[model samples]
Target: MNVMAKAEKKISSAFIYFFGSFGGILFGYDIGVMTGALPFLQADWHLENAASLVGWITSAVMFGAIFGGALAGQLSDKFGRRKMILMSAIVFMVFSVLSGVSPDMGEASAYYLIIVRMLLGLAVGAASALVPAYMSEMAPAKARGRLSGLNQTMIVSGMLLSYVVDFLLKDLPGEWAWRLMLGLAAVPALILFLGVLRLPESPRFLLRKGDEAQARKVLSYIRKNPAEIDQELASIKETAKEERQANQKTSWSTLFSGKYRYLVIAGVGVAAFQQFQGANAIFYYIPLIVQKATGQAASSNLMWPIVQGVILVVGSLVYMWIADKFNRRTLLMVGGAVMGLSFILPVVINWMMPNMNPMTIVVFLCIYVAFYSFTWAPLTWVLVGEIFPLAIRGRASGLASSFNWIGSWLVGLIFPIMTASMPQEAVFAIFGIICILGVIFVKTCVPETRGHTLEEIEEQGTNHGRVKANNPEN
Candidate 1:
């Protein structure tokens, strides 16, 4: 290729990775937007019976996401991955603006906000499932972990953007503050939609649909050498053929049957545990938690989230650099141990002192954020993207994503009520216990997936009679 052509190819590859993973920004934005908005919404709406309302508003998007993820799995399998992502981008922009402009219908305003948030959840959930799958398929095997890890990086970046926006608008009087925070999500959504128009569909999906010519054409955009193109195409084709010939009756239940059951357990377990470990309590309600802990007003608590958000972004960058180099299970366990300690130490210090510095708890929370950002935040998505066979990849990933949202919903709903009744230290102690359990689960159940191509992972599936095997070096 000429110099100009090479530069153009490099730019194209950059955008493909950026725009392909851009949905994660939307996912993280909607999540972080509410963290800043909830306190303002409560004040303006004069919310009575506030805890339940808070739970409903916070958890509503997660409820919608469960269905959206399942539906996207089926749809993306039939229609191309590209189209489903485009659909998600449209949903994200529209509902986000509507959420910001929610009407005040007396007591019904809460219901309206919840409804709009639910719609936003649908888009977020779809993007969560589709982005990882699409990126994993398009990227080369050697670079797949880092490319897929970029989704989590974008997710943290989105959260950081929301935090910055929230801090900027926190002083605005009445409802405009939260409105801008929620509505501004549309800007990123628009960017994702327009940029994706220039991108090609996933080559694996195209090849699976029997369009080898188009698949090769798309692959050529990223793969320079003809030999490289032929080798990857052959691998993808071989995996597709084996999946088709081996399992004519691949149902969702196959995930739970003898051979694939363990894979489902590992994939779905980590995804669910990521949420159950209670990170969202910090991501979604840090201001509220700080307000209660320090007896300070919610609006004044904005800077703490920005601090946490920075830690989160920094940690994800660390993961992006090292993800391809380590065993997936090793990182999960080490991070989990640190995360568990971060949670447990705060509770212990608070109990021993009884009047300890709230900033100390915040420091541990930052530590927890740093560890979770690199480990569970990224690797859970990475494992789900690579572990399942192509035949079952879409649905299984959707199932795992749905389970993830379900855990988020439970934590979002219960955290407020639990905090209202119990002390902050005790509440986090519960999460600390859950975090330790997560570490145990990772050590016992999860498999290592380093240095394996998607095709090699699939071959191991064929040999082991399931999509993922526990031996870790197959």
Candidate 2:
């Protein structure tokens, strides 16, 4: 490529990466904003004593996401990933405003906010499923890990941005403060919508739809070498043809039978474990946990999220560096081990020294978040995006995303109640156990996908029982 042509291609590639993953900002902001807003929301709605009600409001988006993810997955299969993402951005923008302006109806307003946030959750869920698949499809296999992992980078960056926004708006009147925190999500949604307009559709999707010409065009922009573009297109064609012949009608049944069953289990297991590890519990309730632990006001501890957010962002950056270089299974195992230890040690410390400093728990939680940001958090999406067959990628990813949201919903809803009923350390210990289980799951089920093409991964899935025999890495 000539110097000027190379520059233009670089700019185009940069824009694709930014806009394709931009939906993470919307997803991250919605999930993280409530971390700061909930304290004020509880006071405004007189939910001080109603832990269940508070939990419901906090988890409502994740509840709605379950349906949203499943539906978007099926729809994206039919309509194309780019179009579904565009639609999601629009939903995000509209519902974020509605959530902010929810009518005051005493406790009923909480339900109103719940309904609105659930609608917004559709977008969040769709983005979670779509960004990874889209990035994986658009990326060259050699660069796929780093490119797919960018989705997590954007996710943590969005979270950090939300934390900063929450802190800046903390001094506003409670009603306005929370309202603006919820409402400001619309700005990133708008940016995503605009950016999606300029993005090329995934080449794999285009080829599957029998638009080889357009697929070639998209590959041209994303893959600079002509030989590489032709090679990838040929591989996609071969895989799509085999998938069509093997299963003329792809459905949920397809995912549960034959070669696909193992892939789905592996993908969905990783997705679900990512949340079941209790990262969201910490992310969503950091300030509240601090309040309960120290008797300090939750509002005054808003800065804690900023601290956690910074750790998350820094960790994500580190993950991006190592994403393509390390084995996925190794990263997950190592991260889960450290993360579980972070949680377990806190409980051990509290037992040994009953009068330990309150900030000690917060410090451990920060360590948990740091390890999580680098490992399971990003690798879940990377593996999910890489492991599925081409014809079923959309639905499989969506299924995985829904499972992920289901785990998030359960943890977010139950964490506060568990903390209220038991010692916080005990609740965290449960999560620690779950993390240990996660490491075992990765060892036994999840295959390493580092440096492998999607086509190669699918071939390994086809030879299911031989995967461990052939690779010795599974």
Candidate 3:
């Protein structure tokens, strides 16, 4: 009631938001830092062992990410988001130090890099899943989109840091410079580990496990006050009661028992295409592409990534603003369109080079970033997390996340081959087609989850004319 107390509460809430969001930074850092380190690794390690050696080296992290993402869904569902993330942070710290100190390419066993990348991918995958899960649970109902949107911001910012490190260390010996750049990630990993260690358990996770007391403990901080807590708990219980009822009948066959099948397919499919749309094509290979484009030295390529990081960060920031103003479905639709169109920019730039103005192509690239960061990047995670039922959420998110990582690994595994085997036109064309398909998928299947409680989201999908979340005890 007092001015200072009110201000203190506001500051406390802001701090929670900041700390909650720091997980995203780790996710972003893990994704981007590899680029800066890869060139050094090739030279230090005998990546020449196979004709596809470079591809194996690069795809190794994604391969690990595949398993990591799958592990996150099941683990987070059972262990709680905060705890799972802390465990992930430990992985990050260990890998960060080991990756940096890995013996030079000649002396270091090729398997060493593969093993470390796989381990790091586990950390990245866990952080990616848990950060969104935590943000979705803690954010105010009205601000969920924006709050979850922070994950995108943190990811891009983390990526920006990698670029900055890459730029600063560009001139250093790749082996030495890459090590330091990567090892620096340990700092954020430690911070996430310590900070989340002090955080409360997710109220929803608690409720899912029937721990009302601890749920209330977390809700007490997240809600405005005791009255607000009461109001929230009432909704949670109502929604949870529905989930509890749903669990009575939920089974392995539940995914296809009725209307729920379409949802499962659509949800997982959309999440999968987020990568198929070739977003990672840019994220993972931009450095190498940029190095080729400007005739810049390897280190200078990082500056282009900083440009990309800026575009990605700014676009995602806009999602926080627009996620509320417009229809969630509409944002997704328009974003897909823009992204689909933008895919042609690269092909066009490659076309117009040596003859036409390149600025137009440059502008398109930024616009492409703008469209994706604002739309699919944040919205996909929000929808996936909110769209499934609690009984199946664990299985659903696990299954869906695995789908996502599989797509990610597909890109990682095939992109190098694609680059080596195909022309640039073919790569951009593949992504453009995938984006078009994503737009169709969204329009046809996914629901608009705006203003719905977690309970309501589950109710939207029904089985045999009965609410899936309200099945009678059998």
Candidate 4:
């Protein structure tokens, strides 16, 4: 009976973590399924020449994400992370079906899909912000990086699943193919909703709510040792008390004030740069890009996303291995340098050869995805989850997530327009420059949080503020 009880506890803990991070699947599926669905959508809606409409349809989720992230952040703080995730799951299920059944009314059909998808974006944005914070809170500092990275693993896995689904269903007659692709997201949303029903609230949130007995109960399941649970709860309680006394009230402006300002800059900057570096431009439209460069049929181009998806999944697996071992700054800097070169090399090769093989572009993009999957893609959320103080963590994380979506929205919205007007090499070259700047930002602004407890990280931020205050010249 004792052995059986231990096994059951382990199983329950694993399920909690799995469902806690499962929101990433919903987020990743919506972003990726569109890649396969867009071509069919264009044909079904007669939008072949309407580049701007395509951009809006592609970017609409991101636009909605901006508001959703911000709103969820505030609400999660007040209501708790578990509740917000459940709410997000419900939003995802409803809007996903609505998106699939959208009536064809010419241009209005496209507009209708955009509106439904934008509503779906609410859930996507919430998941993006909630998963990291929840995962970070549940995990021990030693394992936090690897555990939190599970969110990214789930995200890329969802993308891979979407790509595979797109390939399998690409042959379905007419609009039904894309419609089913959009509606299928509801399945995962339903799974997340049901699974989250059993998840415990964050122990830290429970402590903040002045529910010590419940917080202790929640921590017992996550932390194996009773002594460690007591220590962690005490540390969290002390931090919460100090934060409450110092700030007295939390607001959006709190993220930009005092010691938090520096932390916010680092966290939000990392989040924005992750998207601004143009990974999504490839993820969202690789099929279209391959068609334009190689003069291949769009239908044939669907295979390329599966190739990218495989690379991403493999890279994410590799990241889970190295996540705790390496310094966050080291990974970000190295990945940024390589990713930037991947983009620039194609432009340089084309200049030297005058007619570079289009397949070379595909090879270089795969390299970019490989590096991004392991680094900025997962580390951004890891850092965002670690760097903020407990009092404002929810709101600050939301601010960071909103900025992430803003960058994604811009990339998705403008990539087609920019490609329409300029050389593809030139467009990618711009992204390469942004990558270099990102490396600089990480080196100077971001601190090393590897193996540090959340309390210790917050203390480091506080100490750094003191150092800066004492020596203004530094």
The predictions' CA RMSDs to the true structure, in order, are 2.9, 2.8, 5.1, 3.5
For model 3, residues 1-474, the per-residue Cα lDDT tens digits are 477445433435556667777877877886787677766666556453342666666667677777777687777777888788888889989988887777754544566867887888888877766777677788766778777787778888898888788778877876787788878999998988777756777788898788897787677677767987777777778877876665566555766656477567766877898888878767777766555444455545667778888888888878888876776678888898888888765676667674644344445656777788888888877777666766667556666766777777778667767766776555766788789889898877776767666666666665423222212221
Better of 1 and 2 by lDDT: 2
Candidate 1 local Cα displacement, residue 82, angstroms:
0.6
Return the TM-score for each candidate structure. Answer: 0.95, 0.96, 0.88, 0.96
Clashing pairs in 2: none
* Model 2, position 406: C-alpha lDDT score: 99
Where model 1 places Cα greater than 4 Å from the true spot, the runs are 1-11, 465-474
Error of 1 at 352 (Å): 2.6
Q: Pick the candidate with the highest lDDT.
A: 4
Q: Flag regions of model 3 displaced more than 4 Å.
A: 1-11, 46-51, 105-108, 225-228, 243-259, 294-296, 345-363, 463-474
Sort all candidates by lDDT, best to worst.
4, 2, 1, 3
Give per-residue CA lDDT, model 4, range 39-75, as digits (tens).
Answer: 9988888787888889999999999999888889889
Pairs of residues clashing in candidate 4: none
Which stretches of candidate 4 lie above 4 Å from their native place? 1-11, 466-474
* lDDT score for candidate 1 against the true structure: 0.86
Against the unseen true structure, what C-alpha lDDT does each candidate score?
0.86, 0.88, 0.73, 0.90
lDDT of 2 by residue, 1-474 (tens): 477545544548889988888888887887799999999988888898898988989999998888888889999999999999999999988999998898998878988988888888888999999999999988888888888888998998899999999999999999999999999999999989888887888888888899998788778888779999888888889988887786668889988878788888999999999999999998899999999889999999999999988998898889989887788888899999999998899889988999999888888888899899999989998988889988789999999999999999999999989988999999999999999999999989887788778998888887753255224244
371, model 1: CA deviation in Å? 0.5
- Supply candidate 4's per-residue lDDT for 396: 92
lDDT of 3 at 13: 54
